[model samples]
Target: MSERTTFQDQPHRTVLLRNGTVHSPADPFATAMVVENGHIAWVGSEGAADSFADGVDEVVNLEGALVTPAFTDAHVHTTATGLALTGLDLTGVRTLADALERVRAYAAARPADRVLLGHGWDASTWPEQRPPSRRELDEATGGRALYLTRADVHSAVVTTALLDLVPRAREISGYAADAPLTGPAHHAVRAAAYDSVTPAQRAEAQRAALARAASLGIGSLHECAGPEISSADDLTALLALAAQEAGPRVTGYWAEAITSVEGAARVRELGAIGAAGDLFVDGSLGSHTAWLCEPYADLADGAGQRGVCHLDAGAIAAHVIACTEAGIQAGFHAIGDAALSAVVEGVRTAADKLGLARVRAARHRVEHAEMLSPELIAAFAELALTASVQPAFDAAWGGDDAMYARRLGPERARTLNPYAALLRAGVPLALGSDSPVTPLDPWGTVRAAAFHRTPEHRVSVRAAFTAHTRGGWRAIGRDDAGVLVPGAPADYALWRTGDLVVQVPDTRVANWSTDPRSGTPGLPELTPGGPLPLCLRTVVGGHTVYAGPNE
Candidate 1:
């Protein structure tokens, strides 16, 4: 029998922290803090710490480190993120030959009979700018069941052996020779590959991913699991782990478009916040499956073929209504303009059916609404949706000469992921890495938003940081959790920072100047091209889940 992992209950005690710059909402430069009963008890300058420390159970000197609330990754695939770390990682293969060589090396290293699973291959960055053909992958893997997903997770390249094993794959749509499998075919083949992995392996992968999140100073992560991304059993195991551990908290999102009474009942039993996130309204742009306003500029085979739209207005409206009535958040994975348009109409329909106040109070969410028309943006604001976004998308494939430009033409490409516009419209924004798709780099994500390629859409550093930290808590209706003031949850990170500088958009795109009037203190310098802070410790609910050398 597999042993069940159980977390020991922790008894709270008073602990005093001193000689550090506290990045609290109340006081940014506070040199002392007191945590007790699993919550922040006091925060002040060092002058008043001695009195508070007099009877505390323990006293810790922070040694001048920076203290702030630990990050909340608004969207993540837990098992997949962890598996990527332990599996063949092809994050930055610069040439086609390099990719082929890596595949060859990886396949040789694995057991002869074991199926090979890998992710993070973007042909756009390579010199050839193309993925390998099925025959090439079959030659590389020697007929083993091999599946290498694209960087966007929207499509994948699989060996013929794998396709033969998945007999249904041949009957599914979106199957093309020498091209990545997308739409239904991609989903089927991908499922078959992962289905071979044992439950123990899945558990281990989740544990590995959660450990990484803790080490990265993340205190909470929303598991965006669904019928498409993962099974109900996977979500259960993950939520169980988070509840029992002294680690990053997990808020679950089961992505499914509710179609029937049975489906609504199943969603409530999934042990998640809502049936939202990655319940695909559309596919990703990288795979040419994202529901776009017009035909992709690079489309060669299918003349005038726009991307796929999985859900129409009626389906979206039905899902939204069911979720709203159930008192759970409703969201969709929308990247392109057509998808966002569908989502907006759905939300509007739900509001009309179930009073706008009821819908707004539910605080429904939408993931990766990357392309939005002004009308759609206004609708999102009116519906009060949380835009769960990944800044690294723009950082990696957002430049004029990058993949997005090639896919949608330069003018249209530059219009995607309008962070400032969304924020200015009073829509709540939650930033995340989307894990294997980007990476679990919170500071890197912050930098990307502040230094967007299009200067006009860049947000202030504080706003970007707030969106990442506080916006995540707000995403799932946890308004009291993200901030670090007295009476808040004792969840935070300690960092070893360097010369602190603030960035502002100016005449030269980035002025790299600190503003005295801003009243913010000592954030890591976020120039267009700059370094990020290294986290030394991470604390969740007054418990240290990760401690670096200093402890």
Candidate 2:
């Protein structure tokens, strides 16, 4: 295997890809595309491709493959995802004992690690229904400092030794002697753990993550980094690596609250696109920290134990106004109803003060957005707020017997992730994996949304596909990318697929869309149990980032 050349090294390449099914709005039945100088110069039928056949520098015979715009994961934690890929992953450990054993073995295997870091443990499914205790973790790792985060990344169970690294963590609001830490405590411990990672290790993890994404046909990624989630140096390093490599394009969002133009400028200095991403308005439901209108059915702590609220409506309003004035996108991580309500109130106040058009023009986004009301859905459309969502969340924790139903009652759980409502109400949707929380499976994500556990919330596969692709580009205020149209950036993937067909949740619409006269460019069959298309090649800005198997 030879080292792959990056787009930066081959800036002016001209290539023609022919004999493939091209999914383009410009030509629904197209089977060819021409790329020149990192942009789509032309896209049409096989006959039209003949004119450019003798003129291109290189010609790729796609051999009847399916070509579509490469996917854009709207929200991701790059370094964390990489670490999970290269380190201990407790994603499906059903027993508490198994999780502990995995931790013990992992610790023994990596004896020289400064701070042991791992993710994706959900105690909700454990028979004991509890996370490993600090003492248990101490014994598991022989008192080694360890930070193991929950699947949601909102909380963690840290060894006492790790807590000693951050002495003030004990004073944080959500800290407890034995229970998993939340809020400031979790953030503090996570920082200490990640800070222990050397620059070389971090770079290797990031490269592994980008390579995995490229192989999965992901052409762009929205890095959701923050002071609490990840450090500024981490984001800078990842961005530099992406810029210097041939992998997916990475757009970084630094989740910091801004109250002045100076703060916004400082965010720009960090090489971030906006002061947005995982700006926590609240926490996650699994951690029992998401701000809710009502108390959790499972917790009997008190009458008013309805999750935690990190930011009030006033603080949210201040940030929105500041970001809007500075011409930067602002976003919040709001899951529960109360947190979402605060976001709506704050954005509405900003709209009132800055004029609706000015505020809406900023196109600020909200992450997760799982627990939404009809009113909130309307508010998102009115304010032009992009709902950066993860359908995998629904697939993982939804249904009557899952974690969501255990947290909130089954009825309320069914209402979570209202994709159909959001789409019908005209809210712009950008799909993501929130990788490490859920694995990055683009076709699986589309299937999850189309075949939602709660049927009423289901969206068409085409709609979900668009949300994962072009919607991500639109979220970052780019309209010229993430599509197969001429003049668009040449970021696309070639997939060895079965047959292209229209798949929709609604039978009436499915009947119409499947008809040839509808002119809808078909996608692969995304039935729940069906196999997804395999990527043959992935190109970013006209350069091949990944060529699978023998390609």
Candidate 3:
């Protein structure tokens, strides 16, 4: 990996980039952009570029590349993402046997490590239709301490040797001897697993994850860290690294609920933007732990199994009220219908207590809001809450025969991730990868939203792109960045792409917008199986963070 060159360390220079398709609202047909002093100074056509050509310090011929605002992944686990990128990644493993074999190899290769850590194993896709048993894991790792999380990161299957690290794990809720751990049990084991990582390994992982983000044209990351999810030291270390480096900006959110001014102060002291991000209201659907209004279809004990609810309406209301009064953002991780409903009810209550306008101004967010009803969507709009969502979830587990249908049945599954409805209701939408849960593929995320499995839920490509870019900035209470317009922060990416065109999900509105006279800026073709754009360069605040092989 290359070292980042900070903007302050280098002398300021005016750069004129001409002969490229600049995606800017200032001029739809803009072919040139000027960057100076870490900000966009100008954007216009090639014909008008001659006026400032001689005055500029440097000029580059783009060779017809596409320049657009870089992406912001609204939700991520930085350290965990890095670990998955550099360590054993079972993201696409096809079978349980293959997973075991990989684990055996990884364990043998790293014999000096205190704990074996790996992520992205979805047993639902395996032929055996289950995760490896404790004994199977023991045999694979030669009775070593191993901790492997499922794809959702909401649950995990651990070897007995690792389980011993948390003596009370067996007595916690959502613990089963033969099954994967969930709830407090999962948190305990995950903490133990991460605690075993040395500081050097942790810093290396953070750097690796940020570098990967920059390579994919992601310029900002909203790290979802919490006491249960990750330690305060972890969040502080990641933030320090980002500040010292010229990579993507890292905004941390400590996911601990607060009910008092002092509680909010504690979160601010931790270097977090808010007491939000992954403040879990429930678990995940794949783990059968997402708090739902109805029982899971595949559960044998369906009558009582409605997943898990970590926080109630009262707690959510208190946290929101406190955060609002403290002038900080508050967010939650809610996936199932019951969990989303609780969020809505709690926010509504907070709005009632602290005037509606005051609450909305705080721009509180809700993460992974997949199962939303028409009423809930209305509430989100009324409260002006930003939906920090990962479209890749639907692409991975959606459809009639996928894991969603198996868990929630086809009917309820179709109701998940209603992006179009949310947009129609005027609710803000911010796209993300939720890395380790889903890989950091920005273009793939846009494609998934534009070409949703259930057609009714699909949004336009332009809408999806904006959600991944400007929407992320808006969610973090900034409206001046994440765009290529003059006066905006110089955070952008240059891409080697195919033909550029305006693509929409609705056929009725496509004809008018696709016409060149529409004045709409075009993005790279994002057809389901087609090639996505390749990032040639990623720049953050006028500093080049990632340069492709060609550059």
Candidate 4:
């Protein structure tokens, strides 16, 4: 067998890439590129690249491929994603029995004492419209500890044994002994449920997730971690691993609600980029935990249950101000009108207290700005707030009859995820999968935004792609990435184009582009509901992270 090579074994090597259709408006005919000293040194025609390769350590033939800046997922839970990859994958489980059967099989395969950690359980789609009960889990596991997070990760069904570990869960407002714990109760039990996942397990899972990401042409991820979501050690370990390995780059954001300078110092000490990303202002719409101005249309009890507001406006303002004064970003997870309203008010308060320029310069962000009124959208634009959005949420549940419509009324549902409105309002939109909630597919995300359920809310394919690529970098306060240029970081992906079709902003049907003379070139036909480009290789900072099956 051939010996495997890593960047550590071969450092400071120059790579010459040629015979590729580079995606750059600056130089249309740029078919070759040079990566020297871990950065893009030159980009031009193949004829010019040969001369530059004279003193290079390696010359890579592109074999007539397409190259563009590698993708970056703005919001991701690395450990959760990795665990889902390696643990019980409950995605697409049609019936409750199927889910139980899978869990039973998974448990049998692994050690009995090992805590069963599984994700992606959506009862709404199940035949029974109900998840496996605690009794069912206990029966399946023979009293083993098991915890499965709902698709939204806002609720989870835990085995009695695991619930025993977090006795205080019963005191939580949304707690139930046999039912799926949601809101604060879910948060309380989650840590106890994941007690068995050691540092080694987390590292393994992180590697598994990053490897998959690299294979799919993703070069970076903004890890959304916090006290409620994930432990500080988990974030630190993942960051340390990324620094040491030739994997996708990871930027950490600690989402703990900051109330003191000591907390801010601790966040910095833990190597967090900011006190941002998933600092929950509210919960998810699917779980009915999203704080909304109006009560849910499908509420069985009454019209009183709007949702839960984990963080009040005062808390939001305090955290924002703290992060701003410390020259860091402060973000929150908001998905409803009420939560968005509070966020806007908090942002306004922070801006008033701190200078507007300082607030804008901080470039704070909000995750899942799903339900935004025109006024709120305008507020975001005026504040220069970064809308860290997930298109897959709309894709999975945004149609008139989908989950959003079912939860809220059709009229209210129609108002969700107004991608075009946000874009028109000049709100900086950053597209992410929020994976394990949604699968990590950039093309899917872009497609979802372009082909929005609400036709009027659809954004241009170009705009959606930009949001996924460029907006992601800006969300993390990194300007050196996202763009493909000599000065930009050497983070890009090579692909073999299946079909060439240029999708205009206004049109549904894509225009064909086979000839070089066609002013605009078609890199890959990401037509509505079509397969995305097949990645050939992914490169991050001049290091080969993933090579495709054929390569």
Per-candidate alpha-carbon RMSD to the true structure:
2.3, 2.8, 2.5, 3.5
Give the winner by TM-score: 2 or 4: 2
Which pairs clash in model 4?
none
What TM-scores do the predictions have? Answer: 0.96, 0.97, 0.97, 0.95
TM-score of 3: 0.97
The sequence of per-residue lDDT tens digits that candidate 2 reaches over residues 1-551 is 23435455665679999998999999999999999988999999999999999999999999999999999999999999999999989999999999999999999999999999999999998999899999999999999999999999999999989999999999977799899999988888888999999999999899999999999999999999999999999998998899888899999999999999999998898889899999999999999999999889898867447998888999999999999999999999999999999999999999999999999999999999999999999999999999999999999999999999999999899999999999999999999999989998888999999989999999988999999999999999998888999899999999998878887798554332557787999999877787999998999988899999956
Clash pairs, candidate 3, are: none
Worst 10 residues of 2 by lDDT: 1-10
What is the model-wide C-alpha lDDT for candidate 1?
Answer: 0.86
Candidate 1, residue 99: Cα displacement in angstroms equals 1.1
lDDT of 3 at 407: 97
Name the weakest run of 10 consecutive residues (lDDT summed) in model 1: 1-10
lDDT of each structure? 0.86, 0.93, 0.93, 0.85
Q: Who is ahead in TM-score, 1 or 3? A: 3
Report the poorest 10 consecutive residues by lDDT, candidate 3: 1-10
Candidate 1 scores a C-alpha RMSD against the true structure in Å of 2.3
Tens-place lDDT per residue, model 3, 522-542, is: 988888798999999998888
Tens-digit lDDT track of model 1 for 1-551 = 24455442577778998998887768756788999988998888999998987889999888988888899999999998988988887898788788888899999998753679899999989888789888889899888889899999999999998998888888879888668999889989888888877888888888889889988889999989987787888899888888787779999999988866677678767778798989999999899889987889899646426889899988999998988887788889999899999988888988899999999999989898898777888889999999999989999999899999999999999998888889889999999988889889898898999889877778877788888888999998988878788998898898888765565645565465566566575577776676688889998888888887755
Angstrom error at residue 542, model 3: 0.5
In TM-score terms, candidate 1 sits at: 0.96
